[model samples]
Target: MTTSAMETAVEVEQRYGFDLIDLETVRYGLIEIAREMNDTLTRGSFSPLARDIRDCTSAVHMRTENGWEMLASHEGCVQHAFTSPHIVNFTMSEWDESTLREGDVILVNDPWRGAIHFSDLNVLQPIFVDGRLEFVLHSTSHVADLGGPIPGGFANGAQTTFEEQLKIPPTLLYAGGVAVRPVFNHLLENNRTPNLLLGDVRALAGSLSVGASRLNSLFERYGLGHVRASGEYAMDLAEAAMRRGIATVPDGDYVITDSLDEDAIVAEEITLQMTLKVRGDSMEIDYSGSSRQPAGNVGTAWIESTRAIIGTKFILDPASPVNSGTLRPIEALLPPGSIVCVLPPSSCSSHTETGSRVVNMMTQALSEAMGARGIACDTGTSGVAVIGGVDERPGHEGSPWGSFAVPGGGWGGTWTSDGVSACIVSIAANCRSAVNEHVERESPLVIWEHELMPDSAGAGMHRGGAGAIFTIGAVSTTVITITGDRSRSGAPGSSGGGRGMPFYGWLLRGDGSGSTLDPRRAIGAEPLFGVFDENGEPDPDKGTFGLGTTYMGGKVSQLVLQPGDGIRLIVGGGGGWGDPLERDTERVLTDIDDGLVSESFAHAAYGVVLDASGAVDEDATAMRRRDLARLRDQNKWSVPTACPPAWNTATIMEVAS
Candidate 1:
């Protein structure tokens, strides 16, 4: 190159350095800001998901030619942020820079315009340096009631997106450096929990301001040019790290397939298939043969699934930087209208419930292709939250209000160890249910019992994690809504591991009346019913199916508990690892004493002979394992069909058992 051009290039790099650091600093700063913003909403608002469950995300982005580059804070959520580029392009085309003044903001909850769902409100503010757009600060949070046909806005049977709730596109809610009262008033007037919605919106807007302020400060310290350069540097580092990580896996072609129980809304079973081709240091994920997206179904996009699996791997190995560069060697082929590439205007409310199943299927397929190397299926699914309304204080105005709660589920078992019990897994790992004490304080409900269910995990050489049980009572007459999945079936096991228990929910009455609640059903009623539990031996006496239970009302009072009204919740367990016969006898004995694994299960599943004192018969256990191994080898089933030619004993055991 010419001397002048070379000099210019060097200057550009130095200037971009400050911009890069500023970008990254602002990215992390947004996370802390988001937490504080959420805290303010929880303390100031009335929504159960916001104040109690905490389902929200906040982020910042740097403007790029295609759109905004997701700079930081994809941790709070995975769905919306992945589609942020689309949102940015649409917004800029629709609104001019002159329209976005300092203190001005834009608001949208339109799924078509790049939102996960209507319940999640996305707020964006333009950050300017010297009156030119430099970055965008954004936040998204789940509002309990959005003036929907259903109190919680999760209308399961709604045929159209409009029936689900309102759709707000990129409207200039606040302009000319002022709060737009008309827009705020319209939102409040349309919702049951006006105060709560307003509070959440404010919280979202506040987070954006915080991010903008942090960006401005960074700009002053290092200059915008250097900040931009740092982003490029970070991307380069991330790419290098990801390439190195991919090199660890053996180079070859591996394919895996998984399916959904049924598209609840569509009432049809769907398949999600994936093929991973790793050649040297490069990898490509092909989703060509996946099922097509049904009309009006929104859960078919493969990008989210691709990001989720890749993101999970990145999380497991943080030494790998997260950026498009890390994804450079990775390519995805999602057919149009496939489950992974749903057409616009499709119902995607069930995306999380079904998307999780897709992730498991991919993991399962990968495990199969890789011969179970560096992978394991997590608890099949993250349990759903059941929420509704309750009536207390007969003489009081607005005596009825909404409430909700989520139950935990089992983690997946691994080749080396059992799954962790009652832990949320995969993409939704950070989500948590409401604390019992807090639930009682905020709503007219009483928590009866919240404990781990015994022996619910799959039994094998490495046992899975245990599920949970929670019972609650309504202080007064109330109504509630329920939404979630993984109740009908549990996650599948690997090798010789057993399947984790399925999840369930039911309703119990004071008069000894009870009924089964469909996992896909969303209903409203006084004295609502809810349950969150994994599958296990059924109880004929109480008529408990072992999934979950929730009750809305049994009495009438003002946020006070009365006798005879309650709800029950149960979480599921993870799958086990290896054949039970291969489990250590001493380990089985210790499990029996610790109440993790029952003596009967130890004896039956693992072939461990335990005496009355909980001591193991080592000779018998050894003989049983030897016999089992011999049988496996004799049948030519001791190794996986896809095992490499250089496979070893451990590899054989992992693939076979």
Candidate 2:
């Protein structure tokens, strides 16, 4: 690919030969249509994942000579909406015009055919105008339970795709404006929560129906030729804008390697390597050096490449519209069977876990390439907790209930300001965090504790957001699955900034034994203050317990929690930007007043001295900062290394002792 392939704004205008005002009007109209589709889905949804958490995404794709390309999308679950074109193209290729028609809805979730994972059920409806198929409306939602060993499809212990759950190919979920009884019945029977599946599937179909009607209105208002030409012009404009963004970066080859703590089934770490090559106005991402498909379900298919595109958009040109043209100047080379591009039989139930890792890696590489315009790394995990069991609530006794909670982590700091606290991951655009009251109402559980962990953010001139502590207690026996990451290593900071704290999880016993179960311990569970002292520092006597070889809680499957038992999570904070010593003293005082930064952390990390009056001591603080800077300049102090957990069992025990 070359810059010549992209045209200038003037050239695009001349080629399309359409009124600029009309094009802009059509573009906004399409955006309105997409937003309407999104509103329809969420309003009509039944499951909390769709209704409350807003885990679903909707988009509009138009037919092109090469294939289908996205026109406009509801800005939620960015990966899902951006990747819809691939699945639409694939399905259209598999079944021609004979199989697809007006008033018909197609369903598919095969990762090989372009899907985020098995749990993301895709519903596509083909739009026909004047006897020609012109567009496809898409809606995707994470269905609750799809008949697997575990209730939710994020199976951390699965070794094969079959173990993940039922894989639905492109099938006619609704044909000719009517439901396919056999297909619908079979899908409902295969799921643990039939009511949820029934309602969610209908909701997706309903959203598509609304989109079709609105699209017809768009074409009717502006004749077919103008509408079609306007969409093409919109895409061309986006491509040119994207090319301009890429042209700003200094051309070079940037490389980065990172690892997940472990594939739940294997204690060994899973390494991911990437080499980004920039030439002129084009970029190429080569992931041929990543680890082979692991025994667990963390491996993903080709859809993982989209994360690289997403990274490009977020880092370089976030304001640019998301369309097929924005991806024209970028290319990704993913080796088959690698963690990023898994082959057949390899499970992908935990694709989101590894997918987020890819996004983080891309951020690190792109930020290094862009220099001052770069942003620090955010908490690299989505922090998804899936809990399922029978509902004992009044009027719903014996019915199965599932809770998909996304208590997202803190965001990394930018050049100008601190990161946002408890925000959703980068890939999940516009998705909301799970509400505690809603979760409790839907299930037999209590959210006992949910708050920001003070002094958790990385220290810098502009610090990262504070991480959070979440504790959920079960009212009865229930199955839990946690697919998260960033425990072995924290989110790496850029330049001289400090890395954030790692994630920690524990299962507290309700048997009055005061025993806590760490993921790394199979027996002899003991309660310990895993990562904090009286003043929020690492206890010299007690090393971090749920980390490295002693921690395997990042990914767990089918773990049972009894009545009165609770699950606690100390979510990791984001990486900081700039040097800690350079931070404003007044800002540090404000952080102290807000309880975001502790007095000890200010003294230790920032070299700031506070007097008994809770005010900065000018002379002592200046001296302390000078001494700390001298030590750092002489290489006597160094930032913590974000490395993999590769210790042996004996070494882990020695560290614990």
Candidate 3:
């Protein structure tokens, strides 16, 4: 209360407020750069995945307590600076330069050397303001073809890391503000889509240049000291925000376990377990008892996996800043060589699978601790990319092209709402499936159907989102490969919600006959392959097959559709929230009208008894629910299974048996 104390307090508030504003402004500048980078890639990239599928990420970095701090507004990719800060630091250290030249750019894609994989190309450029390293701009993208054993670089059976794709370390991609033509040429020559790669790389460079220019402008407007101080302020603000969010949840220890359908490379299922111990305003997640790494280097490390889970939580709650400071409250322990913490020489091309499971497990655990405050589980996995060879057209030069198609699946229903249908889940949030029209025109394939699979979502008070079904067929002789999860088991639901549908793949023959395909299998010269419906139905057939899998050969109809063969893709639905009977009548009616929920579902699940006129009989519904409640109480209702099975369990059991 003294004058001196009051004066000190006023000065602190004023300084902090000023720094906070400056920090936000700088963060926006960085975001602008990231957006530009994304746009540049979308516009310039020649590959279907980059231009159409949009599988890429961009970020800006400044020095911080954790080595390099990721600026707000950047989409964090699996192995980029956002998820792997240590990798960025390692790259920067290897460069060993305090001051960076104006035109300097570095490219790296070595998973063993701070990069995610050879499929993902990373380009980093340091922004120097007045001859000092001020900021780092980086971008990452999933190139359609990277000259790997497989067309899409997702070699599920890849025995060695070298077979995955071209590996690059901390190589100088650009020096003195000029493109390294030799290096660029080397990369282009090794890939199937040279024109696309070259264009996308330039786009990345352009994005970095824009970010550097922005940083310089900010420095010119505000002193360098202020800019640097602002970066620190951003971290401080994020730390404070995260602490506040954590403090809201009651402190306690909670644990949950989940598993991968199976390791794609090795045909064994693996579990990911976590015990979250939350103290006053901090928490730690331990994966000590989780499954160890696969026999080979085929998974991700525990620390990185844990970081990814934490990253998902942070992203969902943006109020909590995403940085090392926010992660201070979280700790993870995984035995070395465990699936969660694989050591070197391990093939980690599929590390994202473990990371996704970790996210699901962590979220499930936190939901148990905090009840309804947690979001529902997403559709368990992002179905893998099915890349194959391009069929040749007579007049058009034959070249290889592929589709990075994503199957849709169920999302976990939340406390207040149903899950989003037909969407990719957490790990690849920014990537999307290519449109059929564009895909077929560019590649030698025919897309059959892209429709929603009804009743595939788990039922509850609020039903989960619906899954999707898509089909495609080879127009010529081509090779195909698939890499993803959720074929063995479906995504689990929460509370009283029903489990979502599982994913499946198959190959269809010319005579309406079909054979099941393993989710991880790579095939050559297949006529037709696609996702199946919940009832195991294939998309309407289209086109005809030719010899040798090439659409161009005789009796092949040039591999172009004579109109009856195709590939199909099906996405899963999200889970529902709460008990169906507990859902409000109005909400149930709304869902019925929206075509998301069926009339039978409304009555069976929500207990909303309806008359012949499709009108809800309030009194009848109330009476039905009362009886259901009595039955539930008699059975000691508590777990999600307290209610009747959501799907036709009898039929499913009979089929399986």
Number of the top TM-score candidate: 2
Model 3 RMSD in Å is 7.4
Q: Give the 10-residue window scoring lowest on summed lDDT in candidate 3.
A: 550-559
Backbone clashes (count) for model 1: 61
Segments in model 3 whose C-alpha atoms lie over 4 Å from true places: 1-23, 76-81, 98-100, 295-298, 302-307, 310-316, 319-328, 512-564, 599-604, 607-609, 617-657
Off by over 4 Å in 1: 1-48, 78-86, 265-268, 279-282, 294-307, 310-316, 319-329, 394-397, 512-567, 624-657
Each model's backbone clash number: 61, 0, 52
Give the per-residue lDDT digits (tens) of candidate 1, residues 1-657. 101212343453464433334545643453454455445545554565655566765555676653566555543444444455445556666877776778788988775566666777878888887888877776777786777666656555554565667778788877855788988888888877676677777777766666667667777876776555554544445556665556666777766666654453443446777777777655777776877775433364434534545433532345542433444455667676677767666666545655566567656655565555533455555455444464554554354465656666666667667677776655555556777787776566776666665555666667777766556666666554445454444556666766565554434444322212321121211222222212222321122322232222111112222434554445556666666677677777777777666665565556677655657878877776677568777993331111011111122112212
Superposed on all Cα atoms, the candidates' RMSDs to the truth, in angstroms, are 9.3, 4.6, 7.4
- Model 3 clash tally? 52
The better-scoring model by lDDT among 2 and 3 is 2
- My TM-score estimates for the predictions, one after another, are 0.80, 0.92, 0.83
lDDT to native, each model: 0.56, 0.77, 0.60
Candidate 3 per-residue C-alpha lDDT over 1-657 given as tens digits, one digit per residue, 9 for 90 to 100: 101212343453466545444556765665566677667666767777667767776776787656776664355343343454545666787887754587899988776555665778888888776676757777778777678666656566554566567778888899878988889988989887776678778877776777677667777887777766666655555556666667777788887877765554454567777887878766777777778777533466433533445533542355544544445555666677777766666666655556656766766776677776555566666666555664466655467666667665656777767777777666666556687788777777766566666555766776777776556666666565544455444566667665565554434444433222221121211422222223323211121111122121100101223223444444456656667778788877877777656676566556788788877889999998888777778994422311112322122212222
What would the TM-score be for candidate 3 when compared with the true structure? 0.83
